[model samples]
Target chain A: MNALSLRNLRKIYNNGFEALKGIDLDVEAGDFFALLGPNGAGKSTAIGIISSLVNESSGSVSIFGHDLRRERAKAKSCIGLVPQEVNFNQFDTVKSILLNQAGYYGLSRKLALQRTEYCLKQMDLWDKRDTVSRRLSGGMKRRVMIARALVHAPKLLILDEPTAGVDIEIRRSMWQMMQEVNQQGTTIILTTHYLEEAESLCRNIAIINHGKIVENSDMASLLARLHVEHFVLDLARPIAAAPVLEGCQIERVTDKTLSVAVPKEHSLNKLFSQLTAQNIEVTSLKNKTNRLEQLFMDLIDSNPIGSKATGNK
Target chain B: MNYSIAFRTIVTKEIFRFIRIWPQTLLPPAITTALYFLIFGKLIGDRIGTISGASYMDYIVPGIILMSVISHSYANVVSSFYSTKFQRNIEELLVAPIPNWVILGGYVSGGIIRGLLVGIVVTLISLLFTDITVNNIAIALSIAVLTATVFSLAGFINAILAESFDDISIIPNFVLTPLSYLGGVFYSVNMLPSIWQNISMGNPILYMINAFRYGLIGVTDVDIQMTFIITGGFIITLTLFSLYLLHKGIGIKN
Candidate 1:
């Protein structure tokens, strides 16, 4: 059985906005699943429901096959949520925050302390253990939140936009730490606007838009489906007009360079051969980083599947 | 399974907060109740003689003590819960495996302790100005506790509904202030016209104060037994409603 499952999960706010509409998802054990979405795509709402922080209007959510409503405590025990907002008590020190969080899991003093210390050390928060959470820099506070979530040793850890607004150095360190944790048999679920992070870290991907899931599949398969590629050409001499390069489309006009989009299967080799034949000496050539984003944007714009469908099976 | 451990955790956190922020949470009520004792009991006791068939100082003691208890209890939960919301810290408690009732009860218990502590401090300060005779100690103590709990639950609900910092200050400033004063903290409801007196019977705070007053000096502006009934009823209702909201993840979830 999957570690977590949401079947036909629906969330309709009292204000008449449907933040989530029948989203069906599954996280198998030991899978690093990245949930991607634009702003207001209901990522937070989905996490809130699974974490038992928000109630669903209609749906079935099971953690390790335990129905959420029937076995709430058991289901909740297995899931840890690092919210998009750093929601720890600001007045509390890093240690106190983790300890209190463990206490809520009904951990005794000794066990709570041991777990607190371990989690804090793992997140590099041991040195600032005594500092009030609010006084820490934004990155440090984010780390504190991570430690707090992991203190109970939950089987499923959901990180909702954990690296948003964090510095690049902190984000990189956090990514490394997350990788180590994921390797230790915890089924990890991460949500982020950073597609690059999702592309690199997650083997499975699910993208939601406007409160609906648009895509869910293996990361490599989703990127492969795009089958779109781009290559830039450098002319040997300044050409007054745009080059008539076959199979390559001019994407932009810039001084001293031309940005071209090439379909991966249509033969970039032939385009390169043509450029060399025309004495259009290619000074530089590079593939656009994962053309999946363009495909995603195009999908979101034309069909706008996000509005009509809830999610795919 | 062990309720006491959970209870202890809440009580400790609350007392710590009270001691840490004494100037804001503890001192104000102690000072306010002390001034009431000094002016109403000391200066005025000399003019009025044995109002409750005891020393005039004794007549106002229960009101002053219960006043502190109610205000502190209300303030404690209001500020604590609202601050948690403001700082987004409630997620710590919300994401836990603990049951919702436990969370609500723990917070309510904390407010009860702080409210009672302020009540005791005010009672001690009042002793410097007036003498309070404990006619029925158990009843007086129970009433004070019950009153604090009811206000604490009310404050919790207010805090949950409050969306902004200004929202926190508004209810205390307007609704709570009016209700507490008009609840007969100073003068007896009997002094008002018959219609107003009948309406005063509807004010829950009056039942709380007069019930304690009945226990302290053995005199009440309203029926003591009825006051106890009303106070108990309000406490039960508020507790049930607050627990229901917590379980439902009402405003907190949003």
Candidate 2:
């Protein structure tokens, strides 16, 4: 069963801005999905509609078989949304915030308390539960939001840029926690600007640009469409100039670092061997740019303004 | 969904919100109302003697208590709802499965609670300056609750229409405060010239204060029956208007 389904969803704001233009999407139950988009690409608007914070101009959204328009309570109860901003009451304590959110979902007081404790422990915020929300660090506040969203144990979770300003260490920890959540059979839909995070964690991906879905496919399949891959190679020793290689583009980024662009058909082994033959040694290598990011840029570049691309499963 | 739990939660959160900042929500009103009793009821009333066969100090007690109810009720909802919107935490309720009526009921209940609480405090302080006797307990309680409900709903509408903190203050400062003072909290409408007395009848707060005064001291400048009609009318109209705003997501959702 699909955890979420959006059919012909549309949103036009009061100022005559069309944020969403008849977009369709679906995420299967328990799937880790990424809704990647750039700023002003309508990701937040779409999330806002799905969460019922923004009224839809037209179209339908269903969650776990509950139609959003006709069965609003059931649909909303089935999904949990972690908004991008810090939106909880600053004056509220962490525990109170989560418990109140649980109560809003109709959980009994005893049950809400239990869930609040569980979520706080899961987010590693148990010790800070009594502190006011505004007193917490930014990353801790983000975790509190995630914890608040989970207090009701909704089957589907939508995270909108949950780690936008979070430090790398906390972001990785949140990623691990999210993976645990997904492993526990809760479907997760994440919208983020960090392509690497999406690539690393999501099995399926959708890239929206200018209110339209330009690419919707499995992660590996989308990355496979990239014709060229760029890598930054750390040299074992300083090199005089760029290496002479056929069927590849290489540039000297520094005396000891080289940036290389290898076509999809060209083997990295071939380039390494050629470099070794030229008496140059490579210490370590990493992708210069995220592969999904490259494809995303290509998709956005190819699909200009006023162009619409149909989303595929 | 357990709407009972949701409603209780919203009410509890709102109550806690005001209680958490007692200095701001509960204290100032007590001190301000005490000063009114000291100056208007004691200092000035001693010179005016009595009106409607009741001591001048006792004459203003009901009006002062009801005035607290009106202003505090309106202030609670306006400030609380506007703060929720400003902080964007209102999405917490907006995204929930709770119905719009439940949301409306919860916030209004919070305002009513605060309003009545302050009303009780002011009544106790009134006792400090003047001997009080209830002419009709049921009528007094009924009008207090109804008056609170009316103002709470009005505040909800104001919060919905407010674009900023300043916008929230505009209604209470310009309209609500003036109406409360002119509603005869410090003087009787009967003391005014005939034409001005008729104009005072146009103010809704006049009916509420007069009704409450009749209940507490058996003295009223207006008919008690008209008080119920006007107060009930405001309640129904404001409740419907507030619910409509919530349903439309005005100033809340884009």
Candidate 3:
């Protein structure tokens, strides 16, 4: 069964801006999904509509078999949305915020308290539960939001840029916690600008641009489409010119840096051998950009203005 | 869907919100009410003597209590709802499975609670200055609750239409304060010239104060029956309007 299904979802704002234009999407139960898009690419708008924070102009959204329009309560109850912004009452304590959110979902007081404690512990915020939300660090606040969303234990969780600003350490910890949650059988839908995070965690991915989905496929399949990968190599010594190598294009970025694009059919070993033949010593190498980021950019750039691309696996 | 829990949560949060900041929410009104008794009841009432067979201080007590109910109720909802909107925490409720009516009921109940609590506090202060006797306990209680409900709903409407902090204060400062004063809190409408007395009848607060005054001191300028009609009319109209605003997601949602 699908945890979420969006059929022809559309949203046109009051200011005559069309944020979403007839997009359809589905995430199977217990799947870890990524909904990636650039800024103002209608990612948040779509999530807003799904979460019932924004009214849809037209379309249908269903969660766990409950139609959003006709069975709003059931649909909403099935979703636990961690919005990109920090939206909980700042004056409220951490425990109170989670308990209140649980109560909003109709959990009994005793049950809410229990869930609040469990979620706080899961988020590593048990000690800070009595502190006001505004007093917490930014990363802790983000964790509180995730914990609050989980207090109700909804089947599908929607996280909108849940780690946009946190330090790397906290981001990785959140990723681990999310994986644990997914492993426990809760479907997760994450929207983020960090392609590496999506590439690493999401099994299925969807890239939206200009209010439409441009690419929707499983992670490996999407990455498989990349015929070439770009890597940046740092030289042990300064080089004045680019190296000429077969099946690879190399450009001199700086005195000691070389930018190379190696086709998938050509192994890095052959490129290195060619460079070695030219007496170029390599020190370290890294991808010029995240692998998935390259493909996402390609997909976004390939579609011209006001044009649509087939968004199917 | 556990509407009971949702409703309870919103109400509890609202109550806690005000109570958590007792210095801001509950203190000012008590001090202000005491000052009103000291100045108006003691200083001014002593000179005015009496109106409508009751001591001037005693007659003003009911109006003073009701005024507290009206302003506090309106202030509670307006400030609370507008703060939620301003801070964007209203998304917490918007994304929930709670129905619009439940949301409306929860906030309004919070306002009513604050209004009545302040009313109780003011009444206690009123006792400090003047001897009070209830002409009809049921009528007094009924009018207090009804008046609180009416203002709470009105406050909800104001919060929905308000765009800024200034917008929220405009109605209470410009409209509510003028109307409450002109509602005859310190003076009976009978004291006014015939034309002015007729003009005072146009203010809704006039009827509420008089109805409450009649309940507390058995002295009223307007007919008790008319009070119920006007108060009930305001309640129904404001309730529907508030629910309409919520259903449309005005001010709070995009």
Candidate 4:
């Protein structure tokens, strides 16, 4: 069964701001689904509804075949939500916060302790268990929030902007931890602006813009359909013109730098051959890491009149 | 612990949050109440004589102590929950799978614990200042605790509706402080005229203060039974409404 299903989800604010407009999505068990969007693209509102935090104006949601409205207790029991904002009882320690989350689910004291220990240790917060949460560093606090969400071991984990304010190293480690968790059969539905992270970690992806899904498909398929491959070239000498290479769209500037796009069916050897033939001595060449930032930008700009997407007023 | 994992977590967080700031939360109130006893009870005892059968010091102790209980309890939850909203931490609980009742109870528990702890300390301090006797231990202790919990929940709800820091101060300054003073904290309701006497009954704190007064002096201007009933009603009603708002995710999830 699908771990989560949203059918015609809609949310209209009191001021008649249509935050989410008839959205539909299904996340199967054990699948890593990345929901991508720019700020204020109705991502938080959608998360609010799915987590039973927001009252949907219309439509229905179900988890493990349980309806959000009807069998809400059963539906919610299987889901955990980590919102984009870093929020925890700052006065309490990491252990107590996890323990409290466990208590909310009605876990026994011994079990809550056991689970709290496991989560804190996994998040590298076990040593700080005795320290008040407010005393932890930004990255450590974010990790505590993650442990709080995972205390109950819910089957469906929804992480919204999980690495928003963390440093790169912590972000990478957190990603690796989430990757391992996702590999362990708990479906992770993530929302982030980090397109490269999504491209690498998620098997499926959805991009939302201006309160609507602009693109949604398998990760590999989405990248494949972009239909353009880009490369960076370092020249021994600077040049100021777009280079001419067979089966490649070349953009070159300055003393020695070159950026080129080759068709997927064509090989870079053609460019090397052309570069050597033209005596445009190549110093170094490299492929950009798997980053879908361009694709995300394209998704947003796809609608020419999508309005200025302003974040939190 | 299963059902209460979330509950215990929220309560512990709330307690730890306040406890970590003892000077700001607990200690000030204890000191203030002590000053009230020294300044009001000692300085003026020679003139006022005694209102009840006990000494004036004994007479005013219950009111001062009850006043502290109501104010601190109400302030703890109000500030704690409002800070959560301001810092955006309440979003964490709003997104959790826990039931509304558990969330409400957990927070209420924190307020009660703080209020009662402060109340206990204040009561012990009051003893050194005067010789006081207990008339009804169970009713007095229960009312003190219940009144604190009820006001804490009400304060939390009000915090949610408030838009700013000024909004938070308006209630405690304009509403709660006035009601508590008029609630017979320093004076008996019988001392008031008929109209004001009836008006005093409407202030829930009167019941609590007067009940505590009765517990200490075996004297009450209002019936202790009615006091119990009022405190009970407020608890049930405030608690249920808070739960309903929580279930509906009022001012948050909604």
Against the true structure, whose DockQ is highest? 2
Over A171-208, each residue of candidate 1 has an lDDT whose tens digit, in order, gives: 99999989998999888999987777888899887877
Off by over 4 Å in 2: none
Model 4 chain B: lowest-lDDT 10 consecutive positions:
B1-10
Q: lDDT, candidate 4, residue B233?
A: 92
lDDT tens per residue, model 3, A216-260? 899999999999999999999998788788788889999999999
TM-scores for candidates 1 onward, in order: 0.89, 0.98, 0.97, 0.90
Checking candidate 3 for backbone clashes, the offending pairs are none
lDDT of 1 by residue, B1-254 (tens): 34445455555666777788889988888777777777878787778876547576777788878877887888888889888878877777776767767777777888899989888898889888766668899889889888888888888888888888788788778877788789876777877999999998888788878888888877788777786788778878887888787887777887
In order, what lDDT does every prediction score?
A: 0.80, 0.93, 0.92, 0.81
Best by TM-score: 2
lDDT of 2 by residue, B46-165 (tens): 899999899889998998899999999999999999999999999999999999999999999999999999999888888889888899999999999999999999999999999999
Worst 10 residues of 1 chain A by lDDT: A304-313
DockQ of 3: 0.87
Residue lDDT tens for model 4, B1-254: 24555677778778878888999988898788888888888888757886866677888888888888888888888888888888777766665666777777877888888888888889998987887768888878888888898888888787777778888889899999999889887777888899999887788888888888887778778888898888899989888888777666667656
| lDDT (Cα, tens digit) per residue for candidate 2, span A10-73 | 8899999998888899899999999988899998999999999999999999999999999999
Off by over 4 Å in 4: A236-243, A279-283, A287-291, A304-313, B193-195
- DockQ (C-alpha based) per candidate is 0.51, 0.92, 0.87, 0.55
Give the true-contact fraction for every prediction, in order: 0.62, 0.95, 0.95, 0.71
